[model samples]
Target: MARAPSSIVVFIRQNPRTRQKPNNQIRSLTFENKEGDCGNEETKPNPHREPSQNAQNEFTEIAKEVSKITRTKPRWEQTLLSDFPSFNFSDHRFLNEVMKHQNNVLLSLRFFHWLCSHRGFSPDSLSLNALFDALVEAKACIAAKDFLDYTGLKPEAASLECYIRCLCEDGLVEEALGVFDRLRGVGVCPSIATWNSALSAFLKVGRTDLVWKLYVEMMESGVFTKVDVETFGYLIQAFCDDDQVLKGYELLRQVLEDGLDPGNAAFNRLISGFCKERKYTKVSELLHTMIAKNRAPDIFTYQEVINGLCKKRKSLEGFRVFNDLKDRGYAPDRVMYTTMIHGLCKMGLLGNARKLWFEMIQKGYIPNEYTYNALIYGFCKIGNLEEARKLYKEMCDRGYGETTVSYNTMIAGLCSKGRTDEAHKLFAEMPCKGGVRDVITYNTLIRGFCKEGKIVESTNLLNELLVQGLQPSTSSFTPIIKKLCQVGDIEEAKKLWNDMQSRGLTPMVYTQEHIITGLYEQGYVEEGMEWLLEMLKHKLKPREDTFKRLVHRLLQRDQSDDSLLVLDFMLKIGYTLEKGIYASLWLLNFAKRIPDLPKHD
Candidate 1:
């Protein structure tokens, strides 16, 4: 079922995914006296411009004998020189023949090396591509990386990039980077397409860690000319995908410096990335930057910024952006209005949350369950259980509270208000009585009991939940353990912690830290230290108070050595000690008459 290989003619043409920006906007970027160019321009070859049917027919026959000779002959040079004595080995067609057995990349490389070094000829891009494609198909990427050095860049700088493109297309990004590095090592500069290819490859492999360096190399090399916005979009999108929105901003600055106003699409991608990263301030910067380029913020941009701000609980700043969008004549859409309402509710700005809710309704936008649930949750959060009840009843009246999430939100609100009887009635009704029943409902009820200092009740219900074959997440156990610590029932908390581990569940870092703090406060310092080390094994650092408490206890016992050791452990775990902790350490160190402890950076 193997399809015939597409003629090499297909590759030299620009790929279909490449979009063209307006030519007038593209600016030429020049390499300013940088090294590695060897004073020669890398000539881009149109290797596939010709169909060359005659060339293919000749290569087909040449490949058969080359493959047979390569398998049987000790010295390919002697046999190749003897059997193909009349053949012009320097010609592109003959190189294509040698490259057909690209399965033996190292051997093909040897033939390629002998031909270039002895015969003083380089293979065309098509033949080199064949070699790379074979290596890529075999997934011998580590071998491909080393093969680049053996080929060197002396014969054809164009082929190096061609190989890089092939490697990138196949997701061999590391190999692509290796080839790109070799391209520079031997005094040859990479093309803009090669730079873009490596950037794309780095993005593919999720190595955004090194993407900026390659981009900087591309800019400084000056090998690139007439760079367009679409090309810049590729890089902006990559930075955005990796949640490195600042890098996207820097790319925008570079694109502007390159004299092209990156269009709204690029800005949108960065805005979305900023939103996802909860960099609310950067979202505002991106919007203003877009406006500076004469591009207005679109609906998606506003939606992302508002939602992002809401996530960070910066509803006031989100409101400013919402108002800004309105001022610019962009009528707030349903999503935009809902986002602001959700953000306000989350921030406990119930007054403004209600105002926006009514405003959106007056503007003919219908409130969805999200709008209602957010209002209800906000009311519940601010201790306005009456308003929360009213919103929940209104959501059902308006035919929007049929979903399990709506019921769960109402149940959670009631539980938070200590209306356990009402929450219980709602929870029971969720199955056959009315709505959907799920883990959140049980967890919420359990958490409510724990918060109300009803640990025995919470434990009984948890055991019942296991009896009903319901699996509990870490969240289900966290609240109980945290509440147990709050009540100083450390034995019960330890049993629950063990139960969670026995069931193969990983507890949250904050949960363990709380237990450790509780244990430490009760003078069980060794036990607390043991749990702290376990938390560290899971890559979780003890919170500031935990460290300070431990260090202070050591100092209280006049164990200055132990206190300093604890401080060093804190620093080793990458904690910047608090100012109070530093002052304590300074006093302790002075009293101990030791050389001054290392100063805080």
Candidate 2:
């Protein structure tokens, strides 16, 4: 047979004298399985059996044996024992090969311990990693833990690092930390990768405090000859990404103060963080620090600065930075232009904003949705309604499907100019124009109808929505309800009122109270009292004035029976009656004149 590569093992380390010779000569061990897939024969050879069949047989037998032994407790000892069943490896490579297809990690761990304790066996790093990797990939955390604490298994530091990384990838940070401390406790010297892995796991869970502590411990432990620059970069990210920029800055500055070079990414992270927090002053300072330390600032560094300027409403400053970037020969990307456009729009500098808009198109940049909205909104804000309309049509003609925002903006602009009829036209045609209208769209159009006192049109639109199987929001109905009540159309108002319940839309105070007030004002006092009872049913308290008005109206009608009921309901809801109402209640209840004491009678 040809020699295998130096990487693969032909024989494992064991006592040479204990090596067993095969009883039969090695035969061709390949076979076709049920799926016609080829695999190696299990080392157990029955001449009648195919090799592939034997590999499966070996796995099943080992699984059965492991299941049998671990079902009962292990008889563990400081040293190997002939009697301890869990320590039985089945005395073959069966356990090792069995790990390849096994996801039952605890069973694998038991076999792993047995392999480690088996005398004359020195398991290589490959075997150690294979089993542990299987455990983690199977998400057998408890099993991985068992393997970690297996007193008989002593994997080297290199093999242990791999296990730690798998734990981190699973977001099993806490478990990874336990394994890290345990490996080091066993006199295994961890490298920088090991320490960083632990830090990364803590960071994954937003545990910045633990990350800081772990970093300190890594430095003090001095196990590694050098820490990687990426270590500090990750720590900075954890802090800054959590919006703890100051903490990140403190960590970076502390390392720099200690003369530790955590590399350029450290400076870059702080610059980005400072920019994110809109701390323009600190950003500038950090940029200068980067230059002083001979760190090269990339395009990203400049972009963040410009973005910060834009975010802080310093458009002129952002343009200045943009100019600096151009001078440094870094061609500005779309984001930079968008930021500049956004900043200008915010400052009401529409003329400049439009100029940049054309400039961006000329430079072969297609403006995105936000870019269009900003320009349209700018025109609307400056009272250039016609210009806003022209641009909105241009947006649609360019195959730009109208966003809810774009449509709402147009409606809002038209409504602001009292051109609500045109606003309704645009809204009614949104679906045909490939624009989807959400609740905001309906709310905006309904608001326009209510503003123009066109309640009929608003009600029609609401009915159309219901026909289309869409539910109306509070804004959808509240304005129309208020306007109908304003016109004293109580019957129609009552129709809408009942419709609210049938649609499973609960009428709020604005709806319920407005209807009650209109009914009461129109001498629908007895019916208005019914509305209050309904309000109480929904656990919605009537306004105090509404309550008091109803009580007074009921007493005026000589319906003291209803008035007393109202008073009791009010008191139950923690409302104090007006002193006069209380006096009336006293006269109605106990302060009436008796025949013997009624001299005035």
Candidate 3:
């Protein structure tokens, strides 16, 4: 049965699933006479409430007459004027009733315009909301927007919120944001829900930059008196994702001070950020705060702390935290064990590393390649090459695959012990053993060969590295350059030095020292001074010992002018010359019968 006309207002407030069923009743009105009076079935007016109730009845009757004429008459506004000549079309109550009852948005819009043309006709908030709700329900958003522009009315907060939310839902977030600004310009403050809708929309589209700017505007407006946890969560995650963790933390602090908890996910993000920045104090404080607030720190939380400590070279503190988690009955995962082992090995604490290694294995955690590599690295660090090799063999036997890192670690260990031949053999066997040789692989062997004074072999590897399209780093060239300088091949060293720059590599200070010393030793004193000035131009300082040797060589050659130039340039560029070198320059100047001593001022 169709409910009374009063139920139509309740229908608009219902969920879409139920609202679709009653809409027919809102449109069902039978006109029995030319006057368009609605057919009465059962609803009776109250005698005691006659004054206000009669007005409501009259408004309902006129609304039904207008809807009927709009549907059947081609010229609806002319028909409305002729039929209801005595009706107050400018009355707000009559406008609201007609907006609520009208089914066809186009016709309703025409009637609205006709009424608007009447003098003194103004749209109140209720009538505006009714029209917006109808237009939005009919998906006549363009028309609704046109209606808004036509009236030029400042919509109330409730109507603006609904409009903004609909725009956001339609994936028109930028348009919605523009609408929000226009509404606010007219002195309308949308509620917190409205702000959150726009915020959530931008966040969904991954526009955190826009979200942050809008949030700043939201704060500056001071309109939303209360910000819920969901809104805070959005801002927190957005800030953290943008690498603005400190700003995220400030928002979190505000959330906590508001006597609300942002839950574990937010806390974890802040903890992870602090870990990346190595802010252990803040991590500790957050962990403690989480526990105090009845939000327990999960395994990932402790894992981050351990990883951070290990990276900062505080493995002992990391171990303490690891042990505390175990004592508290929290099971450390394989990642945590590997992180601890890697740290302990780096610190050369082999004993503790071995203990943890055995414990992790006994706990039924199969050690992966990283786990084996960490122990291998520890063994290598301690010069236990046999044990390191044994671990590598065991890793291969267990089907962990021959990884390049394992091969590199073992090769580096062999090379460290002057086993260059063995290291080269391992390097050669890498391709057959499914190990891809990276730049480190070539650099390692190059460094090893240079250390053994096998310059020819190192040069061959450098050429092969270039042919394979592997970009060599400064480490790749520095050792080769130094080796050439040691063997009185200053010209060859200069060629390689220029080659490094052509390949877009900047030579380190050590590379400069090698070239300078090589030139001086080869009796190219002038060229050595030029390289020294080049170093100073690039703001590079050679080792103090190298500078001393260069100066003494200048004095031995009796090049007093070049030596004085070197000292003056050094002082000008703020390099403090050693006392012995300065005194030698003074003696050289005095013996040359020069008019003035080398100026110390």
Best by TM-score: 3
Clash count of each predicted structure? 2, 2, 0
Candidate 1, residue 198: Cα displacement in angstroms equals 18
Model 2 off-target regions past 4 Å?
1-131, 134-160, 167-190, 197-210, 216-225, 238-247, 250-265, 272-279, 383-601
What lDDT does candidate 3 reach at residue 198?
86
TM for every model, in the order presented, reads: 0.54, 0.49, 0.58
Cα deviation in Å at residue 340, candidate 2? 1.1
lDDT tens readout by residue for model 1, 1-601: 1111232213212231222221110112111222232122122112323323444444456766775676457566655767766555565545555554333444554566557654436665556555544544444454444444444423356656666787787787776776777777887887666677777677767787667667666777675464567668877887787767788789888888867888877888887787777766777787787877778777887777777777877789889989878887888988888888888887878889889889999999999898888787888888888878887888889887467888888888888889877888887787764676677878999988887888887888788788878888887888889888887888888889999989999888788887887787777777887887777777787777778888877777677777777788788977777777678767877887876689898
Which of the numbered candidates is closest to the native, going by highest lDDT?
3
The residue ranges of model 1 lying beyond 4 angstroms of the native Cα positions read: 1-235, 250-263, 275-285, 460-471, 486-492, 499-506, 517-525, 533-540, 544-601
Worst 10 residues of 3 by lDDT: 15-24
lDDT of model number 3: 0.78
Tens digits of per-residue lDDT for model 3, 158-271: 667777888777767887888888877887777888888888888888888788788878888885467788788888888877888888899899889989989887888788
When sorted by lDDT, best at the front, the candidate numbers are 3, 1, 2
lDDT of 1 at 110: 50
Can you write out model 2's per-residue Cα lDDT over 408-526, one digit (the tens) per residue?
Answer: 88888787777898888888788887778877777788888888899988888888777777778777788888889889898888888787778788677868888988887788997
**How high a TM-score does candidate 2 get?**
0.49
